[model samples]
Target: MPAQDHRAPPMPVVRLVVSDASHAYLDAVQRQIEQALLK
Candidate 1:
């Protein structure tokens, strides 16, 4: 219903910035997920 409502105002845009450490952690997690899927 909310999406169908044309009277609603536009939502604001969001930007995300991740640190180097966060990127490394995400890479490690992705590897873990891939290994689990292969098992």
Candidate 2:
């Protein structure tokens, strides 16, 4: 019998809505992800 792969693939889009004060935090997270991919 073949085994199944339980891991799920990453999603293409991650949508989020935040207050003005939280926008900077969200932008920082997005930048981190982008930088990690560049390395």
Candidate 3:
């Protein structure tokens, strides 16, 4: 359960990929992921 919780955030990236997001969007996502990891 804990492992799946950790893996969950990346799932949204599929949508981002399909949408062809820009670098700024990716950078924001990266920052959120980094903050999550810091917690």
Candidate 4:
């Protein structure tokens, strides 16, 4: 019999910077957050 190793997979990290944003920038930021949550 062999012992099994249990370990959790690593999660990804996202970093971003927004300054003086417009509508497009806000939309992009929202999408990024959604994607991260889905993962």
Which candidate achieves the best lDDT against the true structure? 3
Instruction: Count clashing residue pairs per candidate.
Output: 0, 0, 0, 0
Prediction RMSDs, each to the true structure: 9.6, 13.1, 14.6, 14.4
Tens digit of per-residue lDDT, candidate 2, span 1-39:
123332222222222333544888889999999999999
Candidate with maximal TM-score? 1
Candidate 3, residue 11: Cα displacement in angstroms equals 31
Rank the models by TM-score, top first: 1, 2, 3, 4
Summarize candidate 4's per-residue lDDT along 1-39 as a digit string, tens digits: 123222222222111223334567888999999999999
Write candidate 1's Cα lDDT for 1-39 as tens digits.
Answer: 867564344322111234556788999999999999999
Model 4: how far residue 1 lies from native, Å: 93
* Each prediction's whole-model lDDT (CA): 0.68, 0.60, 0.87, 0.55
Q: Tell me each candidate's TM-score.
A: 0.54, 0.47, 0.46, 0.46
Off by over 4 Å in 3: 1-21
lDDT of 3 at 34: 100
lDDT of 2: 0.60
What stretches of model 4 exceed 4 Å from their correct place?
1-21
lDDT of 4: 0.55
TM-score winner between candidates 1 and 4: 1
